[model samples]
Target: MAANKAFRFFDLPPELRGAVFSQLLVSDESIILHDTTFFTLPSAGNWNFLNVFLVNMQMYQEASAIFYSMNRFTLNAHSHRLPVHLTSRGGFLSEEGKDARRRVRNLTLYLTRVGGEFERVIGPALSDMVLNGNLRELVMRLGPPSSLGASRPPERDMEQRPPFQALLRLLADPYLEKVKLLAWKAHLAIFCPFHLRINSSRTDTESVDNQGIAILRNSTGWVELDWRAMVDVYAPGQKIVRIGDRTY
Candidate 1:
C-alpha cells in the first residue's frame, strides 16, 4: 500500500489559492464599519471569517489586503454615529487599521442632512481619506429634506440650495475617480466622473431626465424605479449640474 502524502494549502498555484480565498472572504454587500468593528449587514448572513487572517503570517498579509481592498465600507456621517476620529496626524488608527484605511478604495457616507454641521464633521474626514488613503470612489447618501412639511417655493435654484452647494464642493476633490449622489425623497441617482464641470447656472434636471428615459428604455431590471417623478421634482427650476454617465 502506498503511504498517504501530506497535503499543503501553499502547494497550490497562487491564482487558484487566491480564487479560493476570494470565495471564502469576498462579500457582495457593503461592509458596515461601525465603531471599531467591521462586519457585513445581518442580511448577508453571520460570518466570522476574519479569523482566517490569523492562520499564518503569509496568509495574514495576503488575506488582510484582499479583505480591505475588495470591500466597500459604509461610514455614517451623523455626529452621533461617526465611526473614526479625524486628527492632524493619523487619527486613532492602529497598525492594522492604518493598513486597511490606506488600502480601502470605495467608501459611502450616510448623512442625515447635508448642512454645515454635517460638512464640518464629514468634510475633514473625507479630506483625510482622499489625501491620506487610497479612496477611488465615493457615494453620498443624503436623507430626506427636513423641510418636507414647510411651504417652500415649487422650484429652488440649485445654487441657492445649501445641500447642493455642499455636494459641489465635495466633488471638487481631484482624488476621487467616481462620485454618486442619492437623495432619499427624489430617489435620484447622479453619477459623476472626476472631471465633471459643475455650472451653477445650468440645472441637471433635463440631462438626468433624458438619462432616466434612456435607462428605462434599455434597462430591464430598473423598470420599477419612478424616473418620471424624480425628474419632475427638479423640473420647476432645480438644476442638476452636468455630471458623468448615467448609471441607471
Candidate 2:
C-alpha cells in the first residue's frame, strides 16, 4: 500500500520537508484556493499554518513565519477616499495582533489629494502600531493633494507637511528607529526644527519646539528622503530652520 500524502509530507526528513515547502511558498503571485487547500487539507499541509508561523513553535516556524513577514501595504491618497480598503487589505488593526504582525512589517502610505485627512487616518494608525511595538519601516509619499473632495486652505496645507513632529515624539519610545519622508512638491517641504527633544519628559520646559516651514521654490517633483539624514534633522538640539542643501 502507498503511503498517504499527509504521511508522505511528514515522512520526508524534517529538513528536506521544510525546504520543499518553503520553495513552494515563496512566489511573486498570490496564493490561490487550491494552494491553500494543499497545505491545509488533513493529508497535506499542517493545520497550524496560521499559528505555527504566526505564534507558537520554532523549528518549522520560519517556514510559517515567512508568510507573515512578507505582507506589505501601499496606501494612495486617491484610494484614501475608501479607507476601509486599507484597513481590510492591509490588516493593520487585527484583533489577534498576529495577523497584523504577519503582514504589516513594512508600511507605504501613498499621498494623493483624494484621501481625506491622510494625516488623521494614517497618523494615528501608524502611531498605534508604533505604540504596540509592531511597526518596522514607515515610508511616506508626498504626492499631489487629493482632489477627490474639498480643498484645504494654503496655510492648512503648510501645516500638513509631514507629521514629523508627532512622529519624533512617538519615536522617543526608542523601539522604532527608521522613518522616511518622501516629498512630491518643489514648494512644499517638511523639516523638523533643530533641537527636537528626544524624551518629552519635561513638562514646563516652556519652550515648545519651533515648527518652521521650509519653502522650496523649484519644481524637481517628488523625491524620497534619506533615512540617516532625516534623523539628524529631527534630532534634539538642532535649530528650527537652517539652510543646508539646494539643487537649484
Candidate 3:
C-alpha cells in the first residue's frame, strides 16, 4: 500500500505542482502569510518547511528563483528579515518565473527615523523599483520630523515653511489619475474638483485672495480642499484677501 501510494504529490507531474504553488501564493483568503488566527502561523513564526524546500535539489532550484506576487511584508523592532527580503527583491513579481518589477501600482511606505538617522539603505532596490515603474498610488507616511524637538520654534518659521510645495511635489505623478491624502498638515491646499469647468460661470469668484486663489483658478481643474490650516483665496479684481471657511 505504501509503495502503491508512491509520493502522490510528486507523481502528479511538475506542471501541476507549479500551478498549485502559484495558486497558493496568489490566494488572498485561503493561504495567508501574515497576521493570522490560532490554526494559521503567526508572522514571526519560524518557517521549518524552508529547510525542507532547500533540501530537495529540484525544489530548491525552483524556490530560489520563484517570486510570489500579491504578498505582504510587515516590519517592526522585533523582526528585520521580512522587510529586508521584500525590499531587496524590489517587490518584483514572477508569473511562473517571469520578472514584472515595473508593473507595481500600489505601495504602503511606513518609514521611521531610528536613533535620529533616516534608513534609506534599508531598501535601495525598492526605490529602484519605484523609479523604474509605473506607480499609480503612492501612500507615504513619514514617521515624524526629526528636528521638531520638545521646544517649539519661532512663529515666523511656521508661516514661512514650504510644506505646501513639498506636499505638491510628493503627491505629483504624471500617470496619477486619482490622489488621496489620508491626513496631512501644510501651508496651502490645492483642490482639483471633479468635473469642474474652467470658463467663467459666476459662482462666488469675487472676494477671494488673488495670489492664493489664482494658481488653482488658472489650472482649469478643480478639487475641494480639506485644509487643516488657515488659507487665503485670491482672484483678479479682489479688493481684500479673505478666508471664508474655518475648516476645509
Candidate 4:
C-alpha cells in the first residue's frame, strides 16, 4: 500500500495561503470587541478564539493580518456612555507591542452619548497610530440621546467630553475622507415610558444650539456623518473665543 502524505498548510503559495486565511478569518459583519474578547467570557476556560493562532509562528503572522485588516471591530461601552472597560492599556489591540492595533483598518465605538475617552486608546493615541498605522476608517454611535437630553445639554462637546475632541480631530484628518464618518441615531428608548418627540422634532428656528441639534436629528439612525454640523455642535468653548480661532 502507498503511504499517505500529511496536509501542509505552509506548502501552499503565499497568495493562495492568504486567500485561504481570509476565508477562515474574515467576517462579513463586524466583530464586537470588549475587554475580554480574546479571553473566556464565562470563565469556562474554553480558550477557542485567537488562541488557535498559537499553533505556530507562521500561522499567527499570516492569519492575524487578514483578521485585523479585513474585519470591523466594534468596541462597546457601559450604560453610562463611558468606556470604562477599555482602559489606557486598551485590552485587545494594545497587546504585545500593538501588532494587532496597528493592523486595524476599521473601528467603531458604541456609546449612548458622545462622551469620554478610552484613555490612551482613542484620543491622541488614535491620531498618532493612524499616521503610520493601517487605520482607514472609524465609526461612533453618537447616541440614543443623552439622559440629560436637549433641555439639559451636558458638557458633551469634544473639548468638554473626554473623547470627542480626539475623535473629532481624527475624523477631520485629511487622510480620512468625509464619507467614512458614520453614526447611529442616539436612541433614548430607555426612557420611553416617559418618552415622546423632544429634541428630535425641534426645528432650527430656536437658539443656535437647537439649530445644530436639528441637523443632527435629521440622520436616519445609522448614516454617513455630517462633520460640519458636528463642528457646529462641538464648536470651541469660551476659552477658544478668548484666545481667538487659532486653536481649531
Candidate 5:
C-alpha cells in the first residue's frame, strides 16, 4: 500500500496533526482571554491566538480541543463578556465556538484589585464552564490591592467591558451584596479540579501597611487568603499576572 502522491494535510495521522496544532498554537505562558483581546489579536509576544483556528471547519474540529484542553487561560476581573467568549453563544454565535468554550481545562482569574463600585459578572459568566466545560484546573489570583482612582475608562483598557446576555439576569441582582455570598460562588464552591493554586503578594514593611485601597508594597510582605479557597493562576492566569508581581 503506497502513500498517495497527493497527500494533503488530512492524510496525516491524528496524533501528528495534533502535534502540529500544539506546536503552532500552544503557549508556554498563559493566554489572555479578556475583553477586546478576544476578537482582535493583541500583541502577546509570539503567543498563538484563536485566529489560527480559522483555517477551516475540519481543522477547527481537530485542533481546537487540543488548544483549550492543554493550555491555561487567564480571565481578568474586567472580562464581563466571559459567557459570550466561554460557555455562551460566543462572539461568533457558532456551535463549534461554544463547544470550544466548553472544552477549556485550566483557567485563571484575577480577583484582587476590584476597585470599582460594581463588580462585573465575572463569576456568574463562568458558571456554566465550571459546571460542564470539562474544566480540570481552576486558579484564582488575588491582591495586592488598588486605590479608588486606579481604574480608568473602558477604552483605556482599565474599565471593564460589558457582560453578555447569558448572565444578564444575575448582573443587577442585589442578592450578592445583600446575602454576602456570591451567586457564582455556589458554582465555584462545588468545583473540584485536578489542579488548584492560589498565589498572593503583599508588602507589610512599613508603619502604614494598608491604607484603604492604597496598600504598601515593600521588601517585606506576606499573604493570607481565607475568603475562598479554590484553584487558580492569570492576564486573568493574569500577566500569570504573577499574583507575585503585584502588592497586596
Candidate 6:
C-alpha cells in the first residue's frame, strides 16, 4: 500500500490563498458594533471571521489586514470606546497596525446626542482615524438629542448642532469622498449631505413616489434615503422621521 500525503492550505499559491481569504472576509454590508458586541444589520446570524486569524501566525498577519480593509464598521459613538479597542490588539503598534489603519476606508458613527461637550466624547476616535487611517466615507446618524431634564435645543438649529459641525471639519479633507448626516426627529427622519458647499443657501426636494422615501438635492449633492423602511428593517419600533419636503 502506498502512503497517503496530507494537503496543506499554505502550500497553495499566494494569489489563490488571498482570493479565498477575500471571499470569506470581504463584505459590502456594514458590520455594526454596539458597545462590546459586533453584528451586521443586513445579515443577522451567528457569523464571525475571527477564527480565520487564529489558524496560524502567518494567516493571522494576512487575514487580519484583509478583514479590516474590506469591510465597513459601524460603531455607536456614545457607547463604544473605539480608539482603545483598536489599539488594544497590539497590531497598531507594529507595521501591521499601520497597514490595517490605512486600509480602513469607511465608517459609520451613531450619535445619540448632539449638543454641549459632545465633541469631547467622540473627537478622539475621529481624530485618530482621520489623521492616520485612509478614511474615504463617513456616515453620521444623529438620534434625538438627550431630553433628560436638560434644556435641549430645537431640531432646526443647524448652527448649534456640534455633530454637524464636526462632520463639516471632517469633510474638508479632500480625500474624503462622501459624508452623510442623517437625523431622527420626533416622527420624521432628515437626510443631508455634508460637503464643500454645505453652507450654501439652497434647498430642493425631489418628489417621492408611493413610498415615503424622498430624495433631497442641493448644489453639494443629493441624499436619498428611506428612513421609514430603514427603521423597520434595522431598528424596529423606533420612531422614524417622516420624509418631508425640506431643503438642506
Task: List residue ranges in candidate 3 displaced over 4 A.
Answer: 1-15, 22-49, 56-67, 75-107, 112-124, 131-139, 144-248
**lDDT, candidate 1, 1-248, per-residue tens:** 34697668898998888888877777778877653344554344666786788799999888777777777887765443444543223442333345456667888876654555555545655666677887778887654344222312222353346544545655555567777755443322332111122444643332234222111122222112222233334333434443353355
Clashing pairs in 4: 143-186, 143-187, 144-186, 144-187, 158-165
Give TM per candidate. Answer: 0.57, 0.49, 0.36, 0.64, 0.49, 0.55
Q: What is the lDDT of residue 54 in candidate 4?
A: 78
lDDT of 3 by residue, 1-248 (tens): 67666566667677787775554333233222221111122332454434534458876555423322333322221122234333333322212111343433454444332211122332332334445644455444422223222223223333233443333333443344334443112112223232233344744332223222222333322233322121222111222212232246
Q: Once model 3 is optimally superposed onto the true structure by TM-score, how far is the C-alpha of residue 199 displaced, in angstroms?
A: 28
Model 3, residue 142: C-alpha shift (Å): 3.6
Quantify how close model 1 is to the true structure by its C-alpha RMSD in Å: 10.3
> lDDT tens string, model 5, 143-181?
323312343322322222333222222222222221111
State the weakest 10-residue window (summed lDDT) of model 5: 178-187
**Per-model CA lDDT versus the true structure:** 0.54, 0.44, 0.34, 0.54, 0.43, 0.53
lDDT for model 5 comes to: 0.43
lDDT of 6 by residue, 103-146 (tens): 56788876555444345535545555667776677787655344
User: Residue 9's C-alpha lDDT in candidate 1?
Assistant: 86
lDDT of 2 by residue, 83-196 (tens): 443445333432333344434455566655313354455556667776664667666665443431233323444432455444444334344545666654322334322223
lDDT of 4 by residue, 1-248 (tens): 33797778799999999998776677767776655345232322454647647779998888888877788777665256344445436565344435556667887766555454454445554565477788777775555444324433444332445565555566666454322444334432211122223466664221224323322354344544555445445544312121123455
Clash tally for model 4:
5
Q: Which stretches of candidate 6 lie over 4 Å from their true place?
A: 1-4, 34-48, 78-103, 144-151, 154-164, 185-248
- Candidate 6, residue 59: the lDDT equals 97
